[model samples]
Target: MLILGIETSCDETAAAVVADGRTILSEVTLSQDLHNLYGGVVPELASREHTRTLVPVVREAISEAEISYDDLEGIAVTNGPGLVGALLVGLSFAKALSYSLNKPLVGINHLEAHIFSVLLERPELVPPFLCLIISGGHSNLYLVESLGRYRSIGSTRDDAAGEAFDKVAKLLGLGYPGGPAIDEVAKSGNRDFIKFPKARMKSGGYDFSFSGLKTAVAIYVSKLNEKELQKRRADIAASFQEAVVGALLDNTIAAAEEHRMARIAVCGGVASNSRLRERLKASSETQGLLVFYPSLELCTDNAAMVAAAGNFRLENFPPDDLELDAFPYLELGD
Candidate 1:
């Protein structure tokens, strides 16, 4: 089936055309740069950008796919678990398009789409695996049973790993979107230069917590003189990155062991981090487990993932009606 996917879950306004879930024919994404100035996403600005570019992006995807609108078998749209206004812009547009095209409409869960992002590249991936999804606003471990079937095993208790990175970067004056900033700076520094605390739950919960780690970095920075902090910034970045990724890898590996799952995948924005990727692959290698992930381009929010997920839903699930609305906080399969 040829599926048209629309995604405006956050700052990115994206659209894509995919064939039978595995083949991505064309994808277009326009990221809103307004958030860069604010050091975080501004929902209102994101929604405006979506409204401005939605049509052109979808049209471009279709054009690039070398297919007319009538060729599309169905339309998939991210319906929830994102900023409401931004989501509405895409959801509303998708609804209109679906109605006009007379194609099946599938409302996708933004988070669920992230999982399919990896599967889009690895269509034969076996299920009953563990997935660690780390991004700007989310960090969770899910046991994926099959397409559209997920059970949350663990999740963040406070700030997500990427959120911590952004906060720490702002503290260090590194810049917005802290993951890349810290990754670049940490390259020349020593990962062991300054050890940060890694929070392990006292109650033995499978959930992750980065709030304490962020606070530890904040307190450490408070004690440093401006000159010393500046001179050791690289070391700080390396050390902090090590602590965060280390804790994440350790818990994830432990989860795989506990669950006896051989395949582990990482998704979402932070999946693009070189350190996390390296560490995760290295760790999985030692345990004789398989690790899967999307390419760098697929790590962040994109319509290709949305399209892949939509294809799955459109095939197995009944089509949704035009009354389908944007769900800002919709939990998957709830």
Candidate 2:
């Protein structure tokens, strides 16, 4: 089936045309840079940008795919778990397209779409695997039983890993979107320069906690003079990154061992982190387990994954109605 996927969950306005969910014919994404000025995403500005850019982006995606609207078998959109106004733009537009083209429409959960991202490149991958989704807004682990079937195993109790990266970077005067900035600088610094605390859950579950780690970094920076901070910035980044990576890896490995799952899939924006990828590779080799990650382009928010997920839902479930509303805080499995 050929599907057109629309995504406006956050600052990105994206559209894509995918064939049978696995093959991407064309995809176009426009990221709003206005968020950088504020050191984070401003919801109001993000909604306005999506309204302005979504039409052009969708047109370009369809044009690049070399298919007319008549060729589309269905329309898919992210309807919830994102900025409400931003999601409404995509949802409303998709609903209109579904009505005009008389094609089926499906509303996809943003997080669930992230999980299906792996299938866009590896369609043959089977289920019964563990998945860790770490991003700016979320950090969660799930046991994926099959398409549309997920059992959450763990999640962040406070700030997510990426959120911590951003907060720490801001305190250190590092720029917005802290993951790349910290990862790049940490390459030259020593990961052992400072020993940061890695939180362990007292309940002995797979849950994660990064708020204390963020506080630790904040406290450490408080005592540093201007010259001292400049001298040890890279070391700070390296040490902090090490701590976050350790915490994430520990829980993931533990979950995989406890469940006896051999395949581990890491998805979301943070999946693009070089250090995380390198560490996962090492762990896979040491433990003799299969590890999978979406391509860099697929790591962040995109419509291809939404389209892929919609393809599955459209096939197995009834089409969502035109009245389908935006769910800003919808949880997975809801």
Candidate 3:
């Protein structure tokens, strides 16, 4: 079946065509350059960009796929767990298309889409696995028993890992989307330059906390002199990156062992960090667990992941109506 997926959960306006959940015919993403200068996403600006780019992006995706509206079996859209205004634009557009085409409509959860990104990359991938999702807005671990069936195993109590990276980068005058920037700079520096705290919750649950680590970095940088700061840029970046990656790996490995699961996967924007990927692969090997990750392009927000997730929902859940609305704070299990 041909499925049309629309995603505007964040700054990127994206659309894609996927066949039977596995084959991505075309995926088009219109990134917001306007947000780059601001060092972070502006909600109002992101919403406006989505409204302006949605139609063109969708058209391009369909055209590139060489498929007509009549060929699509259903329409899927990200309805929530994102900026409210930004999500509304994509939701409204998707609803209109579904209504006009008289087709089935599926409301997809943004976080769930991140997990499904793995399936898009590895068609043979199945459930009964553990997922560690670290992104700009969220850091979570899930026990994915099957498609659309997830149980939260761990999550952040404060700032997300990606958010921490961006905040640290902004402090150091690095550009937006700080993961790549910090990763590049950290390569030449010592990962052990300065010991950054790896926050461990006393409750001992599978939850995470990055806000403390972020604050620690801020304080460390504030105490440095101008010359020291300039000279230790790489060292600071490497040390900070190490702390974040260590926390993630520690928690995920613990979750896997606790749950006695042998398969693990990492998804979301922060999962794109080269260091995190390397560490996860190494840890998975040591633990005798299989590790999975989406293609680097699919790690961030994109319609391809949305389409794959929607296709999974269509196969597992009951049909939806056009009345489905966008939800800014939707939870995965809810």
Candidate 4:
């Protein structure tokens, strides 16, 4: 089945054509540089950028795939759990295309697409596994039993991991998309320079809380002299990154053990961190759990994952009518 996926949930305006979920015929992503200048994403700017770039980007994807609109069996778009204005651009375009082409339209949850990203790489991968989804806007663990099925095992009580990273990086004068910036500097630094507190919930559940850790970094950096701060940038980066990675890995492994699940997967933008990947792999091995992740490029927002998810939903669920609209806060299990 040929599916065209549109994603504009955040700062990226992306479109892709996926065949049978595994094969990505074409993918085009238009990133918003304006957000970087502002130190974070501005919703109004994101929506305007999406409106301007969505059509051309989608056209490029279709052309690159060497396919026409007539060849598509369905259209899939991220419907919610993101900026409502940003999401509307893709949703509106997708609905119009689906209605005009008389193809099935599936509303995909952004978080679900991240989980399905694993299936793109491992076609034989099944559910009943523990999943760690850490992104800019969210950090949650789930027991996934099948497509569109999820049980929330735990989630962040405060700041999401990615949000914490960005905030820490900003405080340190690092650039936007803090994950990469921190990861880059952390390569030469020591992970033990500044001891940051890891928040272990008192409830003894798998839930996470990075807000305290972020605050610790902020406080530590504030006390540093200009000379001391500049001299130990790498060490500070490494230490902060270690804390973030440790928190995620610890909770994820705990979830796997609690659920008695042998398969483990990490998804979303933070999943692209090399440190996180290495720790997850090592921890998974020690725990005797199989670990899965999307290729680095697919780790962030992309259309291929969206289309892959759409294909799964289209194959399993009945078609929806033109009344389907963008859902700003659709839950995963809903």
Point out the worst 10-residue segment of candidate 1 by lDDT. 325-334
What lDDT tens digits, residue by residue, belong to model 4 across residues 1-334?
Answer: 8999999999999999999988999989888989998788999999999999998999999999999999999999999889999998899899989998999999999989999888888877798888888999889898998767898888889988999989988988888989899999999999988888999899998889999998888899899998988888889989999999998888888778878999988889999999988887787777788988888888888999999999998999986677777777677762
Candidate 4 — which residues are off by over 4 angstroms? none
Q: For every candidate structure, what is the RMSD over all alpha carbons to the true structure, in angstroms?
A: 1.2, 1.0, 1.0, 1.2
Better of 2 and 3 by lDDT: 2
Backbone clashes for every candidate come to: 0, 0, 0, 0
Clashing pairs in 4: none
Between the candidate structures 1 and 2, which one is better when assessed by TM-score? 2
Full-model lDDT, candidate 2? 0.92
- Write one digit per residue (lDDT tens) for candidate 2, span 52-144: 998899999999999999999999999989899999999999999899899999999999899889978986578989999998888999998
TM per prediction: 0.97, 0.98, 0.98, 0.97
True-structure Cα RMSD, model 4: 1.2
Candidate with better lDDT, 1 vs 2:
2
Full-model lDDT, candidate 3: 0.90
After superposition, the stretches of candidate 3 with alpha carbons farther than 4 Å from their true spots are none
Relative to the unseen true structure, what is the C-alpha lDDT of residue 99 in candidate 1, on a scale of 0 to 100? 88
TM-score of decoy 3: 0.98
